[model samples]
Target: MTPIVRDFRPDDAEAVAAVRRAALPFMVTTPEGIAFEVDQASPAARYRLLVAEEDGEVTGTARVGLAHQSPTPGQAFVNAYVHPGHRGRGAGSLIVTTAEAYLAGEGAAQVYSWVLDEPHFRTFAERRGYRPSRPAHFLRLDLSNGELPPLEEPPAGYELRAAADFADDPRPLFEAEAECTADEPSDIAAELDDYEDWLADTWSHPDLDRDLTMVAVADGKVVAFSAARTDGHTRYASGMTGTLRTHRGRGLARLVKNHSLHRARAAGCTEAFTGNDADNGPMLAVNKWFGYDICATEVRHVRELG
Candidate 1:
């Protein structure tokens, strides 16, 4: 029987999480995270989580959604994954086709997906009309063995604090995220103007580890931050680490990220992972400085739909 594609059911959480981890080990995802991603997505995102089942066993998953944060309309994305053991069963194609039709029906003019750098994966995406766009690198650090840079004292007038410090009001962190995200390189530029959306999508995310997310505050303002997310187990991932434009000259990005790494190590995290746009030299340099090694590469693939 052909695989069945359908909206994610509550019980599909673990299966979806398993598929994602197997397909992209560098990223962190959990059952709770999967549920939260679909349940808390903003309406403008037009988000949908789909699972492909064969013989009553879940074999693939895909997340389809509009790039609601992008300033450009009709820009959307779909990321699909099939278990290595289930690859030739048509689960991957069915999920991607379903996701694209849904996205195009929702008014998306262009759809983007990330294809693994491996030749087979690239060929599969190309066959589906997804031309290469940009590449990204996934870096890994063995927190259990590799030596992490020792935590350092903040420079004068600069202080380090966990994101938890902003529990009463995360407006400062929100402002910092908005400023840094706008400057980050991307195929689809994003503008974060909605604080409520950020609060719902980011600040409250199930995987966000507020206590381990270090922030660099200068003159009582958030100048830089390293957002941390964990799988509630051994995997710790850097959601993002960025410095404000005005504070670029300083080493705040490195400072906060190193501090967060120390926190993660102390919290029993055995592995740390982060991704960088292949063109993001500064961040790549920072990860290198932290002894991270490149583990995998993924290329952004785009398909223009008329």
Candidate 2:
């Protein structure tokens, strides 16, 4: 059956999530999360969720959008995934072609995609005119059976709190996140200056597990955090974990992430996942200390539009 590409509909949320789970099990994806992304996307993002249907079944999906918050312009991204069972069909190709055309029409000058480091996936991206850029690793932790580092009490003048603790006023958390994000290593730099957008896109996200998202406070201000996202079932993922520059080397990152993992396990989560840039030795070492094993690697690929 020939594959056909089309815009995502509300009812396609479940199928899209299913495809994502099948293609990348390390990441948490849910129907509610999918719906939230489509419904809450800012107009500046020019976001489009494309689905490739074959014989009336969603075989592949692509998330196409501009890097609206990036300091640079004309930057866009397309993450296309096909169910393992559906590979070699035209689904992936159709989805990528459609995504590129849409991004081009939206005035994108360059497009980026993350291709799994496996041979076939790399070949697919190269054939589509993408060149290798940065690499990252996906790590997995066995929350149910693996022994998590014992939780430790915060040092004097510092306290640990759940993200929910900031429900009334999350600006403190946002400030910390923006500071940490600015220091993160990325090919496309993003500046989180819009507090309202952060509230809508991050604080109110459906998958954000506030109870499991741990925050570290010093002098009554947020200094570090481990943002968590859960599937509302057995899967949990670290959306972002970082510490303010001045607070680094104080073990805050480990403190917050370990605390979150322990709480997530107690809350019945069986699996935990996170991604780290290949060159980020500190974070990679941190995850290693938490007994996370590298499960998969992805290489960022970029193509410049003429």
Candidate 3:
């Protein structure tokens, strides 16, 4: 039977997460996180999660939407992945076609995707008119076996805390996240001007491990943070690790992340993973210091959808 592509249902969350795990094992996601993403997306995002089914079995999934945080207009993305065993079944093509059509209808003039850095993957994207742009690396650490850096006390006047400490008022953390995000290297500049949106899309995310997310406070201000996400099983991932501009030279980024890693290991996490843009040298160096090895690479591909 020919594969049929349709909007993802609440029941499809687990299957979609399964497909995501099979396609990109280094990235951590949960079934509830999948549903949260769809439900919390802003209307301007035009988010749609689509699934491709064959014989009543889900074989692929796609997430397509406008880049709502990007200040640039007409920027969008469609990332589609087919399970390794389900490749060559035309599901990828059908999902991409539907995703592009949806983005175009939302007034997107350009769509970007991340293609696995392999010969066939590159060829497939090029065949569909997507041209390669920036490259990124997926790094992995064996939290179960590898020795994590021992936790150390923060510098004078700096205290280590978890995100949970800010449960009553997280505006300070939100402000820090926005400032650090704006300074991070990226193809599309992100603007986090909406505090309420950030609260819905990130702070309250089901996958965010508030206890494992470490922060560095100096002068009672959120200066550095290591955002952590877990699958509630064995996998732990760094959602983002950054320090305020004024705190960069103080090694606060390393301090918070190291503390968080120790917390994760103590909590029984067996694996850790993170992604880095090729040009982000500082963060890459930090990951390397933690003994993370490059497990895979993906090249950003952009297509003008005039």
Write down the lDDT of every candidate, Cα atoms only: 0.94, 0.95, 0.94
Residue 55 shift from truth in candidate 2, angstroms: 1.2
How well does candidate 2 score on lDDT at residue 165?
92
Best model per lDDT: 2
Residue pairs in candidate 2 whose N, alpha carbon or C atoms collide under 3 angstroms: none
Off by over 4 Å in 1: none
Candidate 3: give the clashing pairs.
none
Query: What's the TM for model 2?
Result: 0.99
Residues 1-306 of candidate 3: C-alpha lDDT, one tens digit per residue: 799999999999999999999999989989999999999998889999999999999999999999989999999999999999999989999999999998998999999999999998999999999999999999999998898887789999999999999999999989999999999887788999999999999999999999999999999999999999999989999999999998898888889999999999999999999999999999999999899999999999999997
In model 1, the clashing pairs are none
lDDT (Cα, tens digit) per residue for candidate 1, span 156-225: 9999999999999999999999999998889999999999999999999989999999999988999999
Error of 2 at 39 (Å): 0.4
The stretch of ten residues in a row with the least summed lDDT in candidate 1 is 148-157
169 Cα displacement, candidate 1 (Å) = 0.4
Q: How far is candidate 1 from the true structure (C-alpha RMSD, Å)?
A: 0.7
- Per-structure clash totals for the candidates: 0, 0, 0
